[model samples]
Target: MAVPFSHRLDWSIATNRLAQALTLHRPQFDLTASNPTNAGIDYPAGLLNAFQDPRSLHYNPDPRGIESARAALNLGPHTLLAASTSEAYSWLFKLLCNPGDAILVPRPSYPLFEFLARLESVEVIQYSLRYAEGWWLDYDSLERQLTPNTRAILFVNPNNPTGNYLKIAELHRLAALCAGNNIALISDEVFADYPLTGDQTRATTLGDNGECLSFVLGGLSKTAGLPQMKAAWLTASGPGAGEAAKRLELIADTYLSVATPVQYALPTLLKHGAKIREQIQDRTRANLGTLQNSHLRPLRVEGGWYAIIPTPRTRGEEEWAIHLLENERTLTQPGYFYDFESDGWLVLSLLTPEADFAAGIAAIHRAFTA
Candidate 1:
């Protein structure tokens, strides 16, 4: 019999092997920063205090999740959380999709969606956010990728690595397209709290009078810098139009996967999210300052913790990264690792410790200059 593995599993298959090589080399200034706790920054003691709330002893499992957690989400400065993600996902699946449905996802973004789709048994068709005229969304490419199988579109606002947010106008266009085609909108806004500059507010998930169902995914990972806390949520919004709420409820019930303590502690944890977010934003701002002052030139990332630095004309990024590891003893991620369109790119974590970030940028400069 043939193997049961899916094609998505084959994507990025070599990352693990390359990552293993780095550990053996003991490179300094590891710039592949994703974990908040490992970045050498301290999360506040208030986080622990929030968790000690005695209310956790009671098992209050709401398929819609704790009302307070949803309330905290809705209270965002420029966005509102659709009441229950549990109901949202369930209804989202029902209202617009079925098994083997094709979901549109952004390219040059985080690769996690492929796995997420695979777990859901959904086929993902990636649309390029190809860098042209300064990293705008390739709407033309997106239109070309759509087919009868397409049931939803997924976006990472303030997209990872690329660091761009869905503009307000673009959000309207996306909603219009989805609404017209009876497609759902699934947005991963986990990085929304980290808008790089400007108004720092982008379009919200409220669709045109609920014509299109929208799901916003976020968590304490980037928002509160407490990934270990394992608190993530999907907020469902949009006019249910019909049956949207029912489907969402079923989805949440199937996977009452969240821990009881975490669910109970969510309200307090969310309350503390602001403090954690402030520290992270400050760190990102300072580190970005250091990078800007240095020799390397980074593509404008509107949000997210990483910067994609365009490499020098002569060298490919993997070669540069490998040389940096073996010689400069600095560790950084190659753009190819994140499926960049070309070879002349590198990704650096903005959340690295100040000294390490500074030194890593310096090493990157040295390597690029050489």
Candidate 2:
């Protein structure tokens, strides 16, 4: 008899044809990459010498992670270190949800979320983030998506691709939503450290809120732009947080996945990481200025490293992306890829090298006008 695979991983290969086509084609101006290393930003390497600490040679593993490293991340007395935010999310799913339980995610957000939920045999319901003057949560639609099976509500503060922040009002509403519901609130704040608009609140973290069981996640991936280091963490706080922390501690301990060198050097990486983060933020501001000066008039990005431009749609969104790729040799992501409810939207990375981003914008302009 043949072995069977799980149905959860079964997904359509055809939906990714545009991406696959561009990959096989000649080198194109890639606007889809958010990876900071390739974004042509300079980083401070002096702090990396901390990894040479002789103590790293000793295998010291803790289920809750090293206290000093957790302190470096601002995760307070209780912290669970994971190899990455991706792994942290996986752990959260394992800790909170049983098979077939559901979680609420944002629509017009990153597509990776649904895949992440699926990996844990968890269902995902997407709530719309209505964009007007700025993006705000569509609470009515969100309430409709919630059910008894819903174990948690996840927010990508300064969400990926759209770059929308969870404002104070939205945070208040969410806190109330989770209050007395016995539900967890997970805020993926990896991009929280990057705010395009000057935010009144400095890095709004959800873990400290005493309303519900909340988790605020971040890492060196975006905060420090060190993807290779593989360091990330989540801070669990709020009511019943202590109990959940114990369970999550056990789950994290089972893997103890983070490397000793990264854990030992996290403090230095973060200290120097701030310098690179500023560089990247400046680059994002410059690109935003370029967009503002042009006819594109991108949607106001409150925070995060990506921006979206609503374009005239002569054709379907997918057709537009393919046209931009084939005609302009400029690769861009279609808005629908993020579960956007509308058409005529193209997403671009602010992290693209300055000149390359300008050229991609020029190409897009030409294609749209031509």
Candidate 3:
């Protein structure tokens, strides 16, 4: 018998050149990757100790996850990470939003948003994050595009490549706008823990006074260097948002997307965040110094695991990256790959091994000079 698949799955394209390189030369300097595990950071043994808990085999499915795990999330690094099991998905028809519902996304941000939105059968409307004033959101275009069919705005705090965090004032204004419009806020804050300038205190949680409904997504992928664990969470926060959460819970319950062992081990894994975070921050700081020493003028990154260097316009970023790969055997992500607004940009991993990072920056300087 033959089976038919939904059109939404069509959005799932095999990754492009980046994936091809990894497949071709798996051992090359992986400056293009943001994954901490591959960056050579040491994972603490406690991570394994946490997962070895045999109780995970009991098969308890709460849909919203175990209460203990949820509590740990709430009390952990980010204040908005908390949630009551009952408040877990609130909208029953979130699945019903259909393929045409418009969602706003930022330009010069992570490229995965397009594929993810397509998989959900949702249409993406792009808004520019202009660099004229240090990469601020172009709220003008965003406000103009707010149509009746617009469902939500997708934002990445400490956005990838750009590495700019949403300011507190901007966050409040954004939340109020969404609340007023009765639209939802989908925030991807995976880089929240890596702030370079400020101490690692939780930013204002999305749930303050519950004025606007918000879903902040985070995971062990970046936080604890446990991406292989395949655990991530979507926290819904708003006053009286229980109904919306109930609906989300239904979708999660139907899919049971989170793994049993990982869900059970969440608390212990979350506790280990401090150790992993320390190492990553140190590596990032060292890499930042290397970037500075190269005199290549990297964009100011308040926080995040990657950096974007402004190259000369004469040598296009794609050609520059390709040439560096061939000549220096150094792999780097071209700005075009990440939807950068213009030419002359290259992205590199801050979490790359210190020695490799140092050598790569030197290679980059040579690429630029020669």
Candidate 4:
């Protein structure tokens, strides 16, 4: 007897030798550190006290996660938690789609969603974001991509690596479009709190958007910078949300992947999460200033942890990334890695340590001005 392995499992590349070298003792400034734990940020005092609490010893497990934890999220009356956002995506895929159903994703965005969809045996449809004044959805292309098999359209609020968010007006339009097409609007708001702008219209979250069947996802990973805690949730709202949430809970009952410790700690963790976010924001804002002193033009980001910078069209993006590593001892993400529409673009993580980030930015400045 043979176990059939899926082709999707074979997909990822090594995360570059520079990252490996940094792990070994090589002197390098990695500007792609997205993990807040690794980015040298300080969390609030006494946060660790929640972890070893006596309450975690109880074996009480709820399929939708512990009630208090889910309630703490305040997303809605309907909520489900998972090991991480990836698991949340998988649960949602199973909840909404048949094996071959497709979901629309944004280009020039993080590559993780494509892999997540593939793992669920779901197809991904690409919809482009035009970078005119700033990154905005291409409505014509979006309209053209929907088909009978399209079950949902996903948006990364303040999208990964590109940082632009869905505007309130755009949300209204998209929700109406989804309502018309019978598609669910899935908003991944992991980066929702890190808005680069103070304008609330551009920084809106999708939890309360009532026009469509909406599933808003987020967790401790981005919210509290605690990926190791393995706590994430999905919230449902809109027409038939009550029934859909019940079905989702039944699916979640099978996996029940969240740990009791993390569940019990949710209250304290979310409370202290604000300080961690503040530290991260301070670093990203300061580094954003340092990153702009060079010839490369930085794209306008309304919010999120990553920044996209434009480079000159001299070589392949990978070759430029290689040059940065070899010559400057600095590492950056090649634009193509994020499915960028063209070359001459690179992504920098605002979560990087300020000194290291500044050094990497200075190196880019040297290359541009040289």
Candidate 5:
């Protein structure tokens, strides 16, 4: 018999076939590129020199990571380091859940949660983030999804494709709900630093959340535009935070997945990494301006590195994506990929080069007008 693989390993998708086939032949302007390293942003000189610290030659393992690195984060004494945010999620899942328990995630957010939950034998229930003039959490829908076995609620602050931050009022309400139900809050604030609009009401971070047991996640990925560094962290706060951190420390001890060198270099990386973050902020803002100036008026993006463009409903989102790829040689992601409830929406990466973003915008305009 063939090896009995978990159902989570099933990775077939038919929707991408057309885009893959066309890209094989065409030199396309890929507007879906979000990786800063792959994008054309210039890095600071000798940024890698930070990794050469002599302290890295010695090995002293701490489950919470090196004192200096954790101190550099300033997330407080309850912080723990992980290899990446994905690993952090896995660790959190393991810490909080038993097999078959459920967690509430936000709809129209990144689709990675389901897979991550499934891998841990946990279920994912989605709450709504409906969009009108801007994205707002549907609190009623969220409360209804809560079951006796609901262990946590995971939300991406300034969420992935939707690009809306949790408002101050919203955060307080969510904290109260989680506290009432005895559930934890996982706030993924990886994209918190990249703001495209002036939204003073947005909740910048959940590190200080004191209403419930909260875990705030951030990393060099978006902080410094250094995803390759493989250093991410989670800070536990609110009630039971000390015990939670102790349990999380046990989990981190099992893997020790974060490298010693990265931990040693973190302070330096964070210091020099400010320049890269500035560059990314500038690039995303400039590209967002390019989109707003075009015929297409993208949705109001309060922050983050993505913009949602509502295309004409003359065709389905998949058809529109394929049309753009086939006719315009411009690649974009249909909103359905991120679980947008309706059709006729496309998501573009604001990290795309300005010239390519403008050209892609023109191609999109031409496609609709023609």
Candidate 6:
């Protein structure tokens, strides 16, 4: 008999299989591409030379990361480093929850939370982000979802696919709620730097949040458009933050997974990374405008590198995606991929080169209108 594997490792979705098979058969104009390196932005030549620092050749390990790199974030002594935001999530899960304890995640946000939580034997409860003119947290539903076993609440600032930031008022309310309920807040702010609209009311970062215990996650992945470098930070704040930091330090010590060269290269990468960040912001903005001006209707996006286009309800999201792929050679992510509350939504990455984005938009338009 074969050894049994963890139930968490036992799943694969049919849509991914279909997409892979289709791509293997023919070329696809893939609008679902989110990787910055594949997005055709002009990264500065020799930008990675910072990793060559002679200091990195010497082995020095710090549980909270090397001083220079942590200092580069300017987030004070509360910050800890991880190889990636995914790893940061794993560490936070371990730090915050015991087996079968729960965390609250936002619906219509990135689908990563469930997988990350499951791996740690933590249950994921979802709160709603309702959409009408814009996306806002359904606080009533959020409160209703809370249980005594809930240890933390995770939300993406300017959420993936949905592209809506947590408003300042919402943050205040969330802080109050978490404080009252004794739940920790985990804010994923990787895309906070890429606002697509001039929204002054959005909460930009949770690094200084003091109403309750909080963890603010960010990294070069979205901030500097350098995902390959593998550097991410977690900032702890709010009441009992010092204690939280100490515990997180112990968790980080076990891994010390961050590469030495990347830690040393962080300052240089962040300083010179401004140009790359600008390029990404510009690319996303231009593509968003193109999408807005097209015949298709897209939800209002406040920030992030993705936009949601609502397709015809006559067909399901996956069917529409498969239709476009088969007929127009265009690829899109079905709403189910992000666990959207309803049907008729398809997600597109705004990081595609301008011309290709436009072409894919036209193709989508053609597929639907025909």
The per-prediction tally of clashing pairs is: 8, 0, 14, 0, 0, 0
- Please, what is the TM-score per model? 0.88, 0.96, 0.88, 0.94, 0.97, 0.97
- RMSD, candidate 5, Å: 1.3
254-365 per-residue lDDT for model 3 (tens digits):
7665667777788888878789889999999998888878888888777888888887777778777777777777888888878877888899889899888888888878
Q: For model 5, how does the per-residue alpha-carbon lDDT over 278-336 read when each residue is reduced to its tens digit?
A: 88888899998899899988998888999999888888888888888888988888998
Candidate 1 lDDT over residue span 1-370, tens digit each = 9869866465555555347768678888888888888876666676676667677788777666666666666633122222233223434555466678888988887866666666566787989887754567889889999999999888887788888887777788888898888787888777888877874346643333245777677776777787777767765567553355455556666666666666667777777777778878888888888988887877777778988788777767777788788888898888876777778888999988888989988888887777
lDDT of each: 0.73, 0.85, 0.72, 0.84, 0.90, 0.90
lDDT of 6 by residue, 1-370 (tens): 9988898665575557446758555636888879999888788888879988999889889999999999889987799999999999999999899999999999988888888899999999999999989999999999999999999999899899899999999999999999999999999999989999988788987657669999999999999999999999999998888999999899998878999999999999998789999998999999999999998889999999999999998888888888888788888889888899888999999998888889999999998888
lDDT (Cα, tens digit) per residue for candidate 2, span 1-370: 8999898888776747687767766536877768898878787757669799888999989878787888777766667888999999999999999999999999989788888899999999989899898888899999899899999999998898778888776787788788857789999999988888877743377667767889888888999999989999888888878888899888988898999888889888988998999999898888888777777879978888888998785787778788888888888888988988988888988888887788888888888788
Candidate 5, residue 74: Cα displacement in angstroms equals: 0.8
Candidate 6 residue 359 C-alpha distance from true site, Å: 0.6
> What lDDT, from 0 to 1, does candidate 2 have?
0.85
Q: Worst 10-residue stretch by lDDT in candidate 3?
A: 84-93
| C-alpha lDDT (0 to 100) for residue 308 of candidate 1 | 78
CA displacement after TM-score superposition, residue 205 of candidate 4 (Å): 1.1
As a whole number from 0 to 100, the lDDT of residue 314 in candidate 2 is: 78
Where is the poorest 10-residue window by lDDT in model 6? 9-18
**Regions of model 4 farther than 4 Å from truth:** 1-4, 10-27
Error of 5 at 110 (Å): 1.1
**Candidate 4, residue 305: CA error in Å?**
0.7
